[model samples]
Target chain A: MKKLWLLLLYGLLLTISSISLAEEESAFNWQFGVGLGVSHNRNLLPAMDSPRNGIPQLQLLFDFEYKNWFAETPSLRSGQLFGVRSGRLLDDFTLGYRLSNSERHNLALIMASYHDGFGYSVASGDGISSSKLEGLHNRESDFMPGLRYQFYTTDNQLLSLQVNKDITTHHGDMLRLFYGFRFEQHNWDLYFNSELSWYSAKLVNYYYGVTAAEVRSGRPQYQSGSGWRWHNGLVGVYPLNKHWITELGAGINWYTQAFTDSPLTRNNPEVVSFVLIRYVF
Target chain B: MFFRYRLLLLAASLFWQPAQAEALLSASPSNCVTLQQGRECHAQIQTAWTISQPLTVCLYLDEQQLQCWHNTASAQWQWHFKDMQSRQLILWQMTDSEQKLHVLATARIEVSWVQSAHKKRLWRRF
Candidate 1:
């Protein structure tokens, strides 16, 4: 219900922009772009060998200006609206404000309400429960109130830092902090994102509820413990002849786990590599 | 008398042509360029006439930023590449702001750059 209303409100706002046949005139430009990319992250852990492949990612970004809409607003702190799917649709509708202007240094305030929702099926034979939320069903709204900053060198290379607390919990509390950077080239652009997610053993014990047989799989380390997953990938789009783009990419990911007084300690390593052809107009 | 008003409307319609152009433009070979290394090669493009005004849609290699315009008296236009890569087999398009038309076309260019080696009696059976 919240997601639907938000989409409706944004749609109404976008419709108003088309009233004028002429583009808007201002110093700070308000632009919108929609891109669709398909990615799959495979689990190579010996205990968890199921290939959870095929993730259709949709990205919609906006540049909303408060002072000027057309002039040069060259910085990372510009307010943005973004979403993510870590197996759950995390719709983050945030109104961010830039704090610093220096390219080498910047900070921003991110006030977003994250609608965390996920649904899956479980077989009775496997002794798993299968249930889904109906209209306004098992839903939890998380206030992702966070402040992140960026530091860079004279060359403008990016160095980032972010720390946020997850207020959605049943047992204890969950905390997360992430840091990464961006690198660009004439023939390609590269961005590396690394995130460290920690789940309080008390919080994990209440959610995963892994069985004894599942515990024998040696995957008990990540069940109620802490771990870090590293996602390092580079995507390059070179012009083929003006109308199309030849996209080449390769990425590597590794996750290490430390369970809380559990019977499993799993160190997982995975790799994803593919090439795609894209058209940009 | 109001050229400004007319141009604004023209641009809007041109940008909107991509929705319909997908149907007409989606037909193409999956892989068109099969050459490893190459010398200069040429490719020709022709389009159906849809508008009265001369539609000079520019040609782009990988993006619009790196492109050249084609002045066609008729709807059909042609372009050539001096040097080609594997990406050359990819599709090319013709687009303009004046006419509400978008032309997407692909070409199968099997090039022969081994002319000098073929001239040798040791290699040629002839």
Candidate 2:
């Protein structure tokens, strides 16, 4: 398995080069992009109450970009054998429905998965072996819905507030609200420049907080309850002269599942980092 | 009856591959699987490419060359091992021109001996 990881890194490099070949045209319309990224959960299983550990993750993001998609970027690092990273979009899609006079009300739905390549979140140390690495039960997913008032702050930036919920058969599920500032001056480029998010338990437990009873019975180990997690990320995209894009991002999420734990727990909360590449068509 | 039960136990083994498949040189699955004990196993490689670059695919079950491929399309790589018995770490690799690598994915399937026919039917199906 260790040797296999090295080869996959080669494939990732190819994916990056392919991005430079993306179609170029700028306009205010509908566009679709597919992104593949790897992330790690700095925090470990809640039961461990230790500092957050790491879970290497992979994901697919689909954005409905409004207008032309032309942002490009230079290639970044050719990830390490056990490289752990995370981040958001390079170029994302937005939806706009005209409302009132010149004001447009926008709505966007987002679906993302944390392919916990590691299997489970155990802060302990290296897993059982370099071979099995981690189990598949550790991977998870999330969905988000937001209401936007573009031009609310100015014609170039928008005020965005959103609520997102994560779902995992036995990992983490939480609700978080985002208050963000965006830079959307170009059809091909934009930035949710920065944002602050608050996560409530009523939101997170729906995903991460499973029980021993469920596992013992062979029933699914997902307990839909209330819990909280907190984290914030910056989304930026640089469109290169060619079609490729460089996505630079950083985020830190804290899971409160730590403070409250029984023998059955998911993980402690902490911060993590994200550095990824994107290719859109 | 006991020996027959042991026979069924020997039949359980996870998928294993040989390193030769690494020759495939592009992200994809395994071609040849190495069974540590010659047990029944199933494995295959699936490739996806965003580039026109011909990919080289390879599979490694205990550093042995189980499978190898030199395809010219990124999405043209794939492999699988079927009904084999073995217990070895399986490694699948794909390499490109830049020498960079993508961790396409990995998995571990362990075969164990069981005493009940009832348990056999429940655990043997993936």
Candidate 3:
């Protein structure tokens, strides 16, 4: 039923966008594409093996804009592809409206999916045997509405900050800060970015806490506190032509002790890397 | 007497008739489309024109002179077109006797794009 509602919302947005296009074609723009890639990653949770081998990745790319309204997929590192697998056709998709626009500063109101939830049975079904994450309650992904602010230090440098609260599920809130620098060399666009995210105690505990009923052998009841995670990455993109582009990126995510110490997680930092080729339409 | 009158009328008609003056102008690949507005669209345009008489003619793009021919009946030129907006190519005849310029023919070059370039660059993934 929730999926039905989301689908209706998506259809409504598309209808409005088409009307906008009919009214002023020059003010509306859209791009759609598909991408295939291979990724290697270290699992952040105890449900998956650490340093997992190369996994096939498939992605659908869609971007839409009409005047101050825009819709796009959430950034790669936010939800770990969980939204895609959860029957959310839009999967961490964001719908936003620009509240302020200036040469160096921008502000927007956005609604998006910020994190992926977990189910113990789903983890076990994916080849886990006698995992410590067993017996934990399922965590449902949250849909958050927030505000984003961006500042451009220069033409090639950007700093962004966002704050969001879960209004649909756990009512937990999060804050994220990101900085990126881009440069072009020999027709290749290279970008370097660093991000820091802070999760509220309620949010962390909902995902990482071990309840009394979930206690097992060598696992005691534990409650998690608010914590921070850091990430840094470099990505490069080269346009093969007007319709084709290739991209490669690698990133590392470091979890604070408050998260790593949880029985549901491991202490090792996560590493994610991928290379993709896409044809734009 | 009637045959003689017909012959005289034909001779007068032939002497009074004026020569036909024609001018033609055209551009090959007259339209250019780009991915975004305000971006430079490049094209190699072949502009050709013909005139009935040997008159000095000059080609002007909008208000800028691109090329000129000296008392030529016809001419063709390979032009490098690079611009962000549509423009008109006008051919003008320079009359030495009247000390004035007369328009011979004109063609239009149109520029269009799929998207507007004025969009804000925010939340761009990749």
Candidate 4:
């Protein structure tokens, strides 16, 4: 399975040069900002309680183009890799060379980045019974090489397709399709994003499958197949003059049978929401 | 399963590029021409021209170029400066009847615009 994913990724990289080439533009432009927000996280484990935690948001936007070589952030939706709480702040960080960029449409980028994975350990007094989810090994982080294609339907709408293969440990692969729309009214800027993500069998099994050694009487050894996850959300930011802005967002996630059927997971969909206020500087 | 149709979708979208109007060679003042808050000193393009004719006198604002053509053998041509905007880059180009282009002159004015104390930047990624 890993070999197949590697082959596909290699093929994608080979086609980058044939796609739209990037135009040489000005260089070394960047933006920086900091903010804070509060999130209402939905606990994945039914026996455990989720927390309302305050999270800090920091952004460093720097991009430099020396001829065709370019490095910037990959535009990806924020998602939880393991259960509901385990997430990475730099999920969309990217370093790549632009294959092609045009004014009207079509952008092709080839990038390499670190892909995140999940690890769950039930400690004492953590409010969960580890015995029920025995033998579920940790999914270590891996470096992935990927191809991204973005279609700008307009200034306000976009469609993106990305395929990536993990090159380090588990060698799993993922393909995602995303659609985004932006609108502004009365000083409020609103953005809506919808995504469909497909994970390989190895990825699903490694993260959710129960091993034979750790399986108790109620926890049968299980193997999960490939699965799909759907997520949709809306984010709104209202800028008050030039220095202050307020942001709010909410999203829902639905896991397929491949993940929910596992003994370690529940059947309920997850809901995550947050609100933020920032002083832009 | 979504991967099955990716190539097909991409191929279709490649053909959907919208055509843009030709850019004009004319120039205008940015909203920031007024030295006040929320305004920056910049020149905006007003028209685009495909120069296919001979020109005698031309006018320029900032880096923007506007051309002119004269066909009559005897014509009275004179240049005029009508209330130039602040911090504007001005240039003039002349062309002979044989369609030879030449730079006539260039000049600039200085203007100060109010600067905001709060720093702000907005960007989007997809």
Candidate 5:
């Protein structure tokens, strides 16, 4: 219900902005297509092998700007999470107010989105209940409000930093930094983004910590502390013609000690990758 | 990149006309060029005309008119580019004796460069 109201409110704001700005030549732009993707990730329980699945993929590239205010979702290549079977209707949704854009750098106040928490009930028939990680409460999705800065460097390199705190609840506070290198030649474009993400203790604990009431036989109580994750990815886009492009990308996340110590986490390095062919209209 | 492509299409739309009275203009391949310092590119501009009257066609780089020709039929020009230090909007204009200048087509060329990353910056949206 809250999410619905938020969506309606955002629509109303956009309509109001559109009506107020009659002289400016601003339009809402969007690009969309469909493809197929596959990803492999560790199971929620320890001692279990990684699970891989294929899924239908959806690609969306959208941007709407009114004066200094803008809402944009660059691409699925950036910091995105892909599921094996399930899918995301949208990628990273960022609404921001540009403070200034000079030759060297750009600054803005941004509100960014974080993925939902993961929790599932365990059945006795299923194996690998080794450390007892059942009955854990689920954590809701987080919307983080924060500030971001981007610096353009020589040789087509970019550095970005973002710090945000969850608005839905104070459970999570995050700091993310990225260094990206972009290259373009002929009809091919490639980008490599290396990122480091810091999760506050409260945030990590809420998602991975074990609670007393949920504790059961052989499931000892566990408390997770603050940790960091290293995420790196590469995305390449090749034009097949005037209107079609083939996109392929792969990303992996390396868990920190605190995160791996959690009874729910299995793999140290989780892998996510995708491939798509899209036509622009 | 998307903005550059969109601008090229918008420039083409300005010259759209009916089949009977077509005054169409088009650039072969694309109209936007991005190059590093001391680099250059080439493009060919072609025009379609139905009336047999003489018309003046001019090509403008930034605000300066580079060349002009008086022709009775369709006209095509080979463009050679060099020494572009910044982004430039190139325009092709068509004018009759009545003193009306019409922008028949347009293109953009930009010198590729990147700023040093040592500068301070901050921005966010959510």
Candidate 6:
């Protein structure tokens, strides 16, 4: 599965590069920058809150669009630390191509990593862990391919829907719906985003379920069904000049009973907040 | 009837005379290019015009009048251009007796961007 994904990505890159060379009128737009930020986070697992506040972060900002193809790091999961490693260069990276493009509607095919898995020993150098997860098996992240549809009600308002299925691991599926509204005040650009996601039973169980063999005194074996998660955030961006920009945002994620009912999970919602400054080139 | 019409046409041709020469209007740096859409492009545009006879002339950007000259044969001015879309500059000859305006010449200033606003919004992040 990994090899197949790599092959697909390679083919996409080659196709885009060839198209770029053949078409001069199609402009290739890109932005690169570096950012420094401080964040506060709350993990989904219990007893894993060490060093959650005042965590300094270094970010590399890079995104590009060529004709109908694009690659970007979406800000939906920014500042959230899900202690799983997908072994990708950029967190929350998405590669997609628009199948249909118009003034009011857009449809695209995208490949991305939407969720991260956890291991039995959840301890990490960044200080997130829980004793209850010690006897569980390690869960692996999935690489999903999906379709995305976007509707623009106006220049400043957007609604998007995406559905993806895991092809690399677990064969689980996910669906996400997003709405964003943007407005400008003085020189500041502010955005309010709301997102809702639904995970299939296989996906939830693979990540949050506890097996009978790994049951402990207080950690009984539990299985999770399909679940929903909702997130809402407000972000503000101010350009200091032609090259410098500052951003600050805060958001919360609420998990449904399907996930919270699991013995390996916590009932409290997750909070993420950050402030960053970057220089664009 | 045909002979009478021919005579009238001959008299009219004999008395016909050419009207005034056409006015020439132009602007330097007629195109403004910006890196991003929805951002204003600024330019200092120098506009000039020449006419064969002295007449009351006024320059308009779209429908808004920018400057006017009184009984002038030629004139030039520097205009500070700031806008997000293309606009037309029209020179009109004003007749005092009729209080009517006639188009003399016109020029267009085009506004363009390297990236479209819609595409930028699709990938925007903070």
Q: TM-score per candidate, in order?
A: 0.44, 0.35, 0.67, 0.55, 0.60, 0.66
Task: State iRMS for model 4.
Answer: 8.3
Model 6 chain A, TM-score vs. native? 0.87
* Each candidate's clash count: 21, 91, 0, 11, 16, 0
What overall lDDT goes with each candidate model? Answer: 0.38, 0.35, 0.73, 0.52, 0.56, 0.74
What is the TM-score (0 to 1) of candidate 3? 0.67
Give DockQ for candidates 1 onward, in order. 0.02, 0.01, 0.06, 0.06, 0.03, 0.07
Fnat for each model: 0.00, 0.00, 0.04, 0.12, 0.00, 0.08
lDDT of 3 by residue, A1-281 (tens): 43455467667878888877777887776777676665566767756552224655566667777777777763354424222443446665677789998879979998776766676775554444535666777777777889999899998899999999988777888999999998755345678888999999888888877889988887777798898999888787765545666767788889998788888788858777767776666
Once superposed on the true structure, which residue ranges of model 3 sit more than 4 Å away at CA?
A: A1-6, A49-53, A79-86, A124-131, B1-126
Q: Say which docking band candidate 3 falls in.
A: incorrect
Fnat of model 1, as a fraction: 0.00
**What ranges in model 6 sit over 4 Å off?**
A1-25, A47-52, A76-78, A81-88, A125-127, B1-37, B40-119, B122-126
Candidate with the greatest TM-score versus the true structure: 3
RMSD of 4: 22.2
Which candidate number would show the highest DockQ if scored against the true structure? 6
Alpha carbon lDDT at B116, candidate 4:
39
Kindly give the stretch of ten consecutive residues in candidate 2 chain A with the minimal lDDT sum: A72-81
Q: How well is candidate 6 docked (DockQ)?
A: 0.07
lDDT of 4 by residue, A206-233 (tens): 6667778657676688898899888788
